[model samples]
Target: MSLRIVPVSFHEACSFVDEWHRHHRAPQGHKFSIGAANEADELVGVAIIGRPVARPLDDRLTLEVTRMATNGTPNACSLLYGAAWRAAKALGYRRLVTYLQAEESGVSLRAVQWKIVAHLPPRRGWSTGCRPRTARGTDNVARTRWEARIAT
Candidate 1:
């Protein structure tokens, strides 16, 4: 599929989520304020900016990049992320925040030249039948919060 990011409607975003979940089982009902379309005009990624979960600091919305994916292109994730960020800025969001799996591709970050404003300390929270969990807790929250606050 050729590469290009396009905005998708809520229904289309839900369909993308369904397809993503088919390959990777994640929570349903992901909310995305914007989406990405490829060169083929196919939806490949989605982004959403939500109201601050903890507080509504000075009318700023939290740009929560809930989900992002690419069919196969190396730079597709970046395209999606850039488009999403631009969209967020267009919508008057002052900050953007997202959580990504270390193992997953960091194409989006690289594409946007996203800096690591902060990082969370390693944590030890294990799941019921899963292997050891990744780090968690205060450090992570602090870093994420900081990034959200600083991202423009």
Candidate 2:
């Protein structure tokens, strides 16, 4: 089956992620979003791009794939990742990044030439006595951060 990129509103993208993401909920906000559709014009995947979660990395020139979800479509995830980077670059962004649970093989990322640049240790949920938050963390698992290379 073939796939194509389609324009997706943030709300639509979030809704897709909320329904299909394996272990996380939709993000709070995004700079933009992309959709992958099948020949029938049905949305099969989505990728939400937003500011970097790490405050220090929120350099305006950089954008992050805050979330991605697919209905188990082959190559859909990789296509969305590649499309997200191209879209970001077209909008004049210098970098596109994403974080994934360490257990994830990142085959999709590797297929598109995105390389792991950092390893983030597991963390307790972003909660504290001063500002208690929900425990919907990444299951307290470590993560690997990836970045797309500049195309030649």
User: Best candidate per TM-score, number?
Assistant: 2
Cα lDDT tens digits, model 2, 51-140, are 999899998899999999999999999999999998999999999999989999999999999999999998877788998888875658
lDDT of 1 by residue, 1-152 (tens): 55665556666665665666323322344335566666667666655444443344425555566555445546666766676667666777766666554444454576686655545544334333555443333222222322334333
Query: Residue 118 in model 2: shift from native, Å?
Result: 0.6
Instruction: Note the Cα lDDT for every prediction shown.
Output: 0.53, 0.92
